[model samples]
Target: MSPTEPIYIADETVRALIDEQFPELAGRELGRRYTLEDQFAMRIGDDYGAIFPRLPGRDEHYARVVDLITPHVDRWTFPSSHPIATGVPGHGFPYHWTLVQWISASTAGFVPLHAESARPLGEALREVHTPSPADAPLNPRTGLGLPELEDQFSSLLAFACDRGAPENRSIDADAARAIYEEGEAASQDVSFTWTHGRLEPRAILSDQGAFAGILLWHNFGAGDPAADLGYAANLLSRDMHPHFWAGYGDVSEATAARARAFQVFAALRHIQIDDPFLMRMAWERLMELGLVHEA
Candidate 1:
């Protein structure tokens, strides 16, 4: 497959895999598609979801991490994906896949995890951000300190400024650079913990206007907790910051600054992907932070 082209797993291929490897689920209906980028995911009837990596080696880490985390989800005050089974690469699919118990909830992309749920989000973060074991996996993209990502961040910023931004919008490179520099400098005192790695709105589930569950665990690994904090910051309004901090406990000023930088990093990704819902949110965040403005 070409680098820019996403791998396509036809419905027929999925059915064949199910029939061959998980015969018990063979005749069941395939339901909603949950994701398509880093991996391909879809619901299997009413009870389960199937996840297949778009690239090689993605599902291996996911399976291992999920195994480690499954026991904790029961006490989290919210639902999470529960592993059911695993499948090897076959039926023309090149990567491993996993079957998990599907949790039904509206993605924050549709329902918006409002500030009213900030405390729950904070509490959830505190729970998941506990110290990771020494042998815990590390994700180079989303599971490292800000300083470790400076080169990648610089490249992303340059790309966004030079080519990624939409014709109707502009990214303030100077302001973005300043925020990143501050984040890097403030991130000197790094403390590692388990993080969701990618805590964007879409990965967050909401129900009845409250935080419900977190999905997309491929990015789960040991990293700076502030990275998740920064990603979660996108969902919070200025007034909601106090509520979030109240639940998550006090953080150093440096961590807060680094979180702000991570916030900008996520906004840049929104622009790159042109995801309308998240792009709007990211734009507002940039404007609020004085990093960008109207037109």
Candidate 2:
């Protein structure tokens, strides 16, 4: 399965499975090239829609996808024994099928099960961090090294910042320099190690000082949780909500400092990418948060 090669699950195959079990969508036109995030989608005439089944870990990872979509089908039914989207060889994860509804030529709706909406991060954290007896079940999962996780986090942060747009007002040179310096200092002190190869935070705070926290702890190991906190804070200052940071237990001075530092680091990431949207968004967030002031 080369990356360039298209992984196709034939329409007839999909239709056959649907017809045998869930006949309602049997005759509908389905798309063949759905991405990882675009698992179960339908195209009726010119309209496009998606459906998402509950994934195994990290409910917040799919929050944005769910937030933007609504249920379209009458009854929820599992479509096929196999996932509709196949994983490319180099790709790390498998793509699965979800239900989708086409509304019009340009619009569609997505349906997600309510069970996928929330997670239990706090309990998971306690379980993972607690010292277990020698005879206790030992999880055999491999963890990522600090350097590797940091590199990954840097890349992800840069990518997110590049995609984010700056606000209408521009940021001053002095303020920009300050943000860069601050982020660099913070990164040096932050750790990045995790049981999973990915570096993600359980919570995030937007520029408006709002918080968003995922209730599920996807994977665990030793790392600077502050780095993720910083990343989320940076995202929040970029106009994204901090709702993900909610219910993350008490906010500490360390968390607050890291959040501010990451906000700056996020701004620098946008600058590195030369992404006007993210830069502008970062600048606007700084202004709104009073991290920067115009001369």
Candidate 3:
């Protein structure tokens, strides 16, 4: 299949795959599909869920990511849905898929965690930011420091100003540029650590304002820990900052600056997405951070 073409696996095909490879799971209820850019997932009965890659090789990539992070799962205060079973390609399904323990919790995007919830999140992040092995996966976009990502950030920033921002919303390009430059300056002493590359609102699972579990390990790798910290910090309310920093422990001023810069870049990148909720959320985050103001 062409890489650009969207892969489709119908409900019948998933059912057949379940029956063929996971006979024990047969006849269980299948829930609605949740789609993302690189993969999609559906609830398989009450106890499990299945994730299928939308692009070729993503399944294998995810498998590798799972393997790398599994050892640390026990150390984390929060739970994660690593794969319990791997499904082979069959019945016209072109890539491998996985079955995982279904987590019954709301996501931060929906629940909007309360101030107290930031502590566990900070503690979890502190654990996750441990030094990684030499062979740890590195996603350039999320792993590299702002200096390395300048070109991409520039492109996205231009795109946001030109077409992505909401109507009548004008991003202070000069201020954005200044912040990016400051972040770049602060990111000079880069330290590599395990990072949840896309630690955003949707990836964070919560229960009634409490931190519950983390979802999606596809982007788990080694990078500047600030990227993850910045992304989460941006999602949080300003009042929660003290609690978060207390749990995560002391952070250098440079690291904090880089985190802010990364959040700006992430906001720009998210603006390019077609999802209304994501676009609005990213834009609002940017505004809240002082990158945007009244027209």
Candidate 4:
């Protein structure tokens, strides 16, 4: 990275973490991604790579997620986990940092993604959705059931309306409401399972159109398995859905219904957060699902 480049963590901080944790790799080179905010990946003299992302909370939970994934990804050749969310207490350096063998300097973001990657990504995510053990971290937020999700959506819509729902031709307020309500109605007594809670497109990686690796283990937990699919619904094109689901395994009509409901829920979240790109995709999905008016 250029000296002029803006960084989430200063070079000295990143260097200090490396020196303190894995001193052998200290003073190599530090590079930060322009597109990925608050994250950095370093080249450990080739064949080895590690990333330190700023995961601010849930340190104990994050550790478990990485532990669960370590065995699963062994065959995939992912980095071994040497994660350190912060320096040892009283060491004075308080920041989040984790070290794992970098999968490859060239990740999925290096190139334009294609539909073919959807299936592999589906299968990979399916592997991640395996049943969580009894001791698994059950964060209240992600472990939320239908009622919690409903309340969240209601609050989001109410907040938006309070702000005058801001004018935007891209999203129809009535349509947004319809989709949100429809999602809530469909989410009756839904079961929960292991899920990658925040599997947005950026969290996935690929190389030359093949599934490279998955990133960010902080959000993996026992919750709605449909959560990631909901994210995918708003993030991917309609044409890719079939291929993506094909790799995710057979979905019963009931599961499909729940997935659609979650998708609507996810869309409203995009709008609530004011993420333009996802908001655009979510609105398109709302229209395609007939949750929104044809206009």
Candidate 5:
């Protein structure tokens, strides 16, 4: 199906589902539906939301599924009236959803638009990382404690495992066990965790060297910065540019390590979700870059 078609279909589907599930929303008119290359979007009157059924390998992880839906709901709470809100949701589902809701409510009358007026990959990252008050309530799921991080990491890993790839249909009991154990080890290692305040963008300049809003994703909290960085780095390796990282702050060795680890985990997780496109792309890239070993 064409990208745009899905938006209309999904919008209709969501509207119908919502109407059936919650009749209070039945009379509300959902606005125009638009399709992007990877997602289906709709405007509920002036309210903006999206349906991302195309996200590669997403169906397998309930957390990821919730993550996708959370943003659409959060945006409804605070539509971006301002040219930019300076803070927007980033990576991971629950946290991103929670953060977006918090920022929207805190600002009250403000609407957070894409940074730099036009959305660019780099600027989007900067927006998420722009720090809020230090006393801001940390996401309960990703607070300072190691136990929480480990539990979340393991749960994500387990979810990934449950969504094993076609080749991994049998599910290797040993590998699953190892992942849990290693997840614990990684969480216990304080060096693996790096703390930041919020998501930030890596802006791309226009021909006049003016700020162009680009890549944005969350970049705060105490956890393996490398894991987060590595997740981004793999995306960069695929086609994302270094200019995006240029706007990011210093990258420590520890951060790089964490990023690398996260990259592999993300790859596996994506594969588990049966996202043929992402899986094929990741495997091909790994082979091309000599990152994967042939047995």
Candidate 6:
């Protein structure tokens, strides 16, 4: 991480945190460090990894995402990084933190677009999708309700038109809108299930090319599972998607429709921000997602 980042905390201070709150596990070597939009994470000791999140919003339940997901899919994900005893913010650490079992350097990145890895990715998703309690924490994505999602989709379509790029210019806005409408209608009746909301490839961890543990529970909540799969559908190759769904068990028509809808919006996100690289990826991902078709 750049020293320029304000969230950068010294290793010694982290060690101080360990000595103070988790002395038994203190003094372990720090492994790869991660600086993410919401969190700073690093590996420590032979057994534990930890994250300090710049958690947003006033939602009291947001902080408990790890706590909630652990028990539901303990066998599927890395075990919960239970909060160690820490009080009064020692070492100038500014936000709440949590620790879980460290995944070894043996772990590797998950690439769902590849055929061989897609099936395992599906199974990993299934393991954590059990029913969520009625009181499950709210996902911030809920802030982008169906109407907002639709509007964003339309707006991005217009942005595509404005850019006049071949890929963007070729998109059939009416057809894309139809996909979103179908998804909205399909999702209307399904009851909430536990959803990771954000299931991008970067979020899953692998050991020797096999699914080991999944991470990033900050957006977890009780919601539509199709929306979860929808994001995956866009990320994974279309040919490999069957393997993903096969591992995931059943997919009702409604589920499939919602999945397509969710993916359309997910891909459109790149256009909404107008990041050329990401926008191009989004357009390509839509084809892989099967939302775009050859004329």
By TM-score, the best candidate is 3
Alpha carbon lDDT of each predicted model = 0.77, 0.35, 0.80, 0.57, 0.36, 0.64
lDDT of 2 by residue, 1-295 (tens): 6543434445554555544445544565655433332133434233333333223343232332222222211121211111122112112323333333332211001111121111222222222232323432212122222233345445644454344433333344445445444544443442332211121221211112211222112222334444444443433323333333442344455445554655555444544544344455455556665544423
Tens-digit lDDT string for candidate 3 (1-295): 5877678888999899888999998999999988877788889899899888887655555656657677887777678776667788899887777888889888877887888888888988898889877877884446787888899888988988787356677888889988888989984465688888877777888798788877776677888888888888766777788899898998888988888898888878778866666677788888877877556
User: Arrange candidates by lDDT, highest first: which order?
Assistant: 3, 1, 6, 4, 5, 2
Off by over 4 Å in 1: 57-59, 82-84, 162-170, 187-190
Q: Which window of 10 residues has the lowest lDDT sum in candidate 3?
A: 57-66
Instruction: Give the residue spans of candidate 5 off by over 4 A.
Output: 1-42, 45-47, 50-123, 130-225, 238-241, 293-295
- Enumerate clash totals for all models, in the order shown: 0, 27, 0, 2, 34, 1
After TM-score superposition, the amount by which residue 141's alpha carbon in candidate 1 deviates from its true location, in angstroms, is 3.7
Q: Tell me the tens digit of each residue's lDDT in model 5 across 1-295.
A: 4533322233555565445544544656665543433333333333323333333432232223233233333332212221111211222221111111111121100122222322243334333333334454343222343334455446655664555433433334355445434443453333423222122111111223233222111223334444444444434444344565655655544444444445555555444434455565445434443434423
Across residues 1-295, which tens digit of lDDT does each residue of candidate 1 receive? Answer: 5765668889899889988999989889998666655777888889888888876546567557666666567666656764556777888887777887788888788888777799888888888888877887775445767777788788778767675334466678888889888988884465678778778878888896688878777666787788889988888766788898988998899988888888888777765664688877777776677766445
User: How high is the lDDT of residue 64 in model 6?
Assistant: 68
Question: Considering every candidate listed, which one attains the maximal lDDT?
Answer: 3
| Per-candidate TM-score against the hidden true structure | 0.89, 0.36, 0.90, 0.74, 0.42, 0.77
lDDT of 5 at 289: 39
Determine which window of 10 residues in candidate 5 has minimal summed lDDT.
100-109
Candidate 4 displacement at residue 287 in angstroms: 3.7
The local distance difference test score of model 3 is: 0.80
Clashes (candidate 6): 1
Q: What's model 5's overall lDDT? A: 0.36
- Candidate 4 vs candidate 6, lDDT winner: 6
